[model samples]
Target: MKRPLLTRLLALAAGSLLLSACISQPGPAPRATGDLGLVIERASGSVQLIESTGQSSLARIEGLGDLSHASVVFSRDERYAYVFGRDGGLTKIDLLEQRIDKRVIQGGNSIGGAISQDGRLIAVGNYEPGGVKVFDAQSLELVADIPSTALPDGSRNSRVVGVIDAPGQRFLFALFDTAEIWIADFSQGDTPQITRFEQIGKQPYDDLLTPEGRYYIAGLFGEDGMALLDLWYPERGVQRILDGYGRGQQALPVYKMPHLEGWAIAGNKAFVPAIGQHRVLVMDTERWQQQHAIEVAGQPVFVMARPDARQIWVNFAYPDNHRVQVLDSETYEILADLEPGPGVLHMEFTPRGEQLWLSVRDANEIQVWDPYRLELIKRLPADSPSGIFFTSRAHKTGL
Candidate 1:
């Protein structure tokens, strides 16, 4: 109280410096997550967060349950990943922090999930009890549960497959056991307005929505045709396309079901894996008619297109699982055949299509390739990886 003015000023400065020193320092430099991705290690029930630019693993997140058949979808902001595990686990992971933000066991068995167009709702399709559960994106709270139609015996609900989000906050899915397709409109509220399309086909195994979200096509396993619905004109009902695609020939035993989500579109042509056959069916997208059937090395699992729509890359099921072939889009010629070791599970293209990332399960590695040059660029170690998902999917519809 009686100190000189200069002495009091010096004391105040010393106290301010001490307070600043006691405060916690910043942890790390802020960075963006645009180039980040994840690789699913199916056997270990974990995911490896990776950086696409460096083609390197950044962190390994563990403790997810039963990832034998897992799929992932990203939020609209591309900051979080929603992993749908076979054991009904819906785990929300924070990509920036490399940690699980929230998790819930929504069903007994789940196939996959999709984020709503508005990015506010997460929808999961289940297999065990068979239905769809919609949850709040932020809190992972159950907002709605729409059970599939009951089976003939009334013992259990029909298995749900091919869940995808469409325009106007709507979800479209196929009921495998009931041979039906349903559209759940969530624009109203938590309780969605349901529209059911009956007798779609037998065993609608999987489905895909076009990039523009105009057409929804479901592939049939019990028959040789596909069911297509025009989302723009729901009143027209479902139409059968590519009926009896087997051409009256005896079908071969299918080792693995060809995934419809791997459907490829180049210009006006669509390339799809033919079930129980060693061929890729090319269709004219305008008419939805089979244009050509290109013979391949084995039963094709994934027939995916390059980003520029210049070429298509195909992977096969066992015992031809070791091979991958690139095909010319216009000429329909086999460009290259690559043997990147065994068990080539999945392939994903970078945002600009400069590079392609593939998961080789048996080899336990992720291979990065220059798609245009058809050259191997790098290899990163993973544990029995099955699915390689990039954040670019967050911007695409029905991914």
Candidate 2:
């Protein structure tokens, strides 16, 4: 006559996951998976959790020390969470336990995370050494280390600037400051190797692969334009992107902060953070042409698009104009630039595209903003260098 405890708990978990996917969502359509939730990490090295309806919870982390910039990725099977830290260590978070199950030391400065579509392998960006080290997600064993050099210099140590997984392309792409793209093939059982590593963008900033995974577009802060590299064509392993930063007097500072800090692609547009220029460049992805520049304030540090369909959000590094500027995707105009507080760094929109969560370093708090009204929604107690994610089920939330 009464529901069992296990049945009740399972139902609650499913509901939580669905609600999480829609929390602070930005896009047009609501998530079909209503069991989602959010995971946030602070720069001060703490992690937390948020429910579907914007309820906050405590984040639990284990075996992580001196975490710089880390990323939390949910395994496709939804059994475990693969968390990587700046200390070059990997922690496997068992979903059932909701705590770190094991730790694997990577021995370097880690950046973000990239995993194969199948969730078999993981690739992490190591900055100081400027390389991408691959590991077996299940075993956490060293698979292969893809250095910044595809064609070795034999002299200077190559360093990795950016790394991301291209699902449509089925390969892991890593960007080096020296202007090269390294790909780890995950189609086979063997360890992923550097199949193509050659010069592509001009001192490429962070990179992102198109949804189709045909081309890799990179921001060239060193020059006046961005770089569009032709990937996997094989015949031409690398080509200078049509519209990238061309150095000299004519070249404009495309990014607001250092190296055009906040660059991103939304639908058919490329939003670039012109730090010194105090603006964001909207480029047509199809035409590969510069559309128009939307002006912001201070130094734009990150470009975070509302997880919705219409507007894109931008964040600034400098306190003088630390805010989240929302732009209409259609007209590419600055609709609203809302200031939450001082020192708002990178940010991400909830899967439902309702709220904009920011990692406020100096303020030592994670501020949630109403992307539409441009008002401060709430400020959660968080530290520096933390990460935020959306999920369908209940997980741990850190402070």
Candidate 3:
């Protein structure tokens, strides 16, 4: 049902492929498995694809650099995968064949990467050039390039902080260092128009696009909390929701930079990791208020919730927690503290949320955990890895 719209919307809005372009086959597809497990080996510089249903190797990619950042987008027809590389690289990794199709330049300049929902657009945030680029989903052709730097001065253009695709791919929300935000539409290549938002509160680094796609929730650096930008009235600009909770304070390591050190959004809550205080803060999305601070280990580095919204998963970037922590969503209580990888920062669960995949930044490996039981199932090697995302269809939530 999401089809082309969701992916296209996200491709333009956020500079990330937020594609939900998975297919279930024609008349009758096989019973979907619990999850498609991927373990990125930091040392070997390879990716291992594991099927929980006990199938043979779906595919394995051999040549990749340190493997700093990774995200997968299945084609709208479920034929190929557009792989976005992070930490300065670009290319598409075939999910089924487990091979490199081609190296995509992605606008010549690059910052961070994201895929369109239908896997048709690949978005990139270019830091030095200070702009965002969106590529055609199928051809990988440059469709639009949006510059975010403000000419506050002639020579210097500030960095573009964050990008989020709008629902249905109508527009893109871009944050910049000039304290300005702009909206870019995919329907036309006409120059994008910019609106300077009055800085009412802390400038945010990373942000979440509301499900309604009307407001963008951002975590600020100097302030103790998040800010909400009202998209309902574009000219009206940002609305302050600076409710100081445990993690939004600028002193935290994650807050050290204004963008997403870690952020995730679910039904009614937003999960953020505050490395400075070693905790995960729960925010009420409706009220934009801090509901509670869920204490996590080693300065919560990243927080992600399962599709079911039943459990919240967290990992510490440093050796502080030595294990991944799982919490019950409603009660905000610890369900399990399972050790999986070293220097754990980013992770993803199978579509069913039954298994956990971790990026062992320091360990040169990825640790796979059975989330239900909080136990380690395997440790696969990943070379110089930074982040991880799952591509197999088992994780789709129909929502």
Residues 1-399, candidate 1, lDDT per residue (tens digit)?
699999999999999998888775667788678898989999999999998888899999998999998999999888999999999999999999899999999999999989998999999999989999999999999999999999889999999998999999999999999999999999988899999999988999999998899999999999999999999899999999999999866689899889999899898999999999989999998999999999999999999999999989999999999999999999999999999989999999998899999999999999999999999999999999998899989998986
Best by lDDT: 1
Whole-model lDDT values for every prediction: 0.93, 0.61, 0.59
RMSD of each: 2.0, 9.9, 13.4
Cα deviation of 299, candidate 3, in Å: 1.9
lDDT (0-100) at residue 159 of candidate 3?
Answer: 56
C-alpha lDDT of residue 398 in model 1: 89
Off-target runs (Cα >4 Å) in candidate 3 are 1-52, 55-58, 62-66, 69-72, 86-88, 107-109, 117-119, 171-173, 188-203, 211-214, 232-235, 246-267, 392-399
Question: Per model, how many backbone clashes are there?
Answer: 0, 68, 29
lDDT of 2 by residue, 1-399 (tens): 999999999999999998998896777763232333334454444455444365455455545665655667766655566777778777777654556777787757776666666667777777646577777778888877766653255664455655666643245444555666666666665556456655565566566565455666665655555556555574566544435332232443333334232345568787766535666777677777767777676556666566565777776654554566778877877787576667665676665677766767667677777777777778776655345665531121110
Q: What is the lDDT of residue 100 in candidate 1?
A: 96
Best by TM-score: 1
Task: Give the Cα-based TM-score of candidate 3 against the true structure.
Answer: 0.76
lDDT of 1 at 84: 95
Give the poorly placed runs of model 1, Cα more than 4 Å off. 1-27
lDDT of 2 at 233: 75
> What would the TM-scores of all predictions be?
0.95, 0.77, 0.76
